[model samples]
Target: MFSELQTEIEARYDIHFDDLSLLEEALTQANYINEHPNYHGRDYQRLEFLGDAIMQQSSAVYLFKRYPDWDEGRLTELRILMVQTRSFAALSRELHLDHYVQLGHGEEISGARNRDSLLEDLWEAFIGALYLDQGQDAVMNLLEQVFFSKIDTGFYDRFVDYKSKLQELLQKNGTVDINYQKISEEQIENNEQIFTVAVQLNGKQLAVGEGKSTKDAEKVAARRAYKDLTMDK
Candidate 1:
């Protein structure tokens, strides 16, 4: 029944399912189940739940190992940015997985297949199915090929602003005095000026960084402090 999808999967990721029924279950939706009363197979909800957990573990481990310098907070934020619903939905569309979802007649007409929420669920369900059928290595291989590769400096810049992130983390408990101060400026090679900035908490310097501009230096300092504080925690 999923021969076409199987072929596509094999061609795209070199993965072949041991049991195609798992794939079918992953693609199936509750609406389809409701429409077909005789259908005894499961829908994607349970698989979605399981897939979410698998994604968390897989992504967390990947981030933890790949970025040994990253503090827990940064790793957590990056993991969330990578596995969040919007990201999963975007990935599903990128892989053309949305086209294979088995929606009911009404859902098909209503465009549920295009909905981000549905696509998110479908992606998780598919991951769940793939893990169950082919084991963790297979799923990890798929993720390493398609998912983790998508995370780059561009992705980090788009989702993470270090100054803002640091401020949010520090202020999580209560009001905190956080400030950035430019300590020194010097003209370097090519007549470019370098600025040194320090981030302070509670009237004490936490970390310092240098950049081309005061703002940039402050951002760097904030990032350093954030990483240091999060690591301490």
Candidate 2:
């Protein structure tokens, strides 16, 4: 159904796709097959499954060699962060994978094209297809090219603390000065005042929250602001 993209994808990656059928399967969404009962084309689900396992192993090996001093617990956390949905989605977007994905009419109308889960699954399926088409070495090289680029730039560190993440994201546009402004303090039944805070970006209110203290309120506000500014898009 999406044969048009075969040429563009190959040219973009400089790949001579031997198994074009597998590549097509990797780009096919389940919805596309479900919508066409007689269609013989396979969905990306199986490829996504294999890709996930390969991604986990590759990330673990990379982390093990890259951080020799870190213990198991820290290494595991770092690996998780590196292969998380957000990370996958970021890489997919960077690769412009969305342009090549095939979607059913319903999914396209519902705005599923830019969904993080969908992007992540498509990325994994692409990895699985690449692994099948070339080998583990090719998949590893592609992953390192994308994932390692982020690692070298300390991308995961920004998300280690969501508050720091929100701040960094807001600060990307130098003109928009962001701040967490305390709105009010109201005494509760226990005589403890609940602080309400608003995250403002360039005088515009991004999000608001209430907590037992100013610090707590700021964190809550930051979390909400992060979700609002990021998830909606």
The most accurate candidate by lDDT is: 1
> lDDT values of the candidates?
0.87, 0.82
Model 1: worst 10 consecutive residues (lDDT sum): 152-161
Range of the 10 consecutive residues with the lowest summed lDDT in candidate 2: 1-10
At residue 33, candidate 2 shows an lDDT of 87
lDDT of 2 at 171: 74
Residue pairs with backbone atoms closer than 3 Å in model 2 (clashes): none
Model 1 Cα shift for residue 220 (angstroms): 17
Model 2, range 102-218, lDDT digits (tens) per residue? 789999999888999999998898888888888988887777677866876767654556678788897786756888899999998978899999988888998998889998888
Could you estimate the TM-score for every candidate?
0.68, 0.66
Candidate 2 root-mean-square deviation in Å = 12.6
TM-score between model 1 and native: 0.68
What would the per-residue lDDT of candidate 1 be over residues 1-233, giving only the tens digit for each residue? 48788998899889998898899899999989999999998898989999999999999999999999888987987887788877888878876778888889999999998999999998999999999888999999999888898786344343446898888988999989998888999998999999999999889999998989998898779877877887655
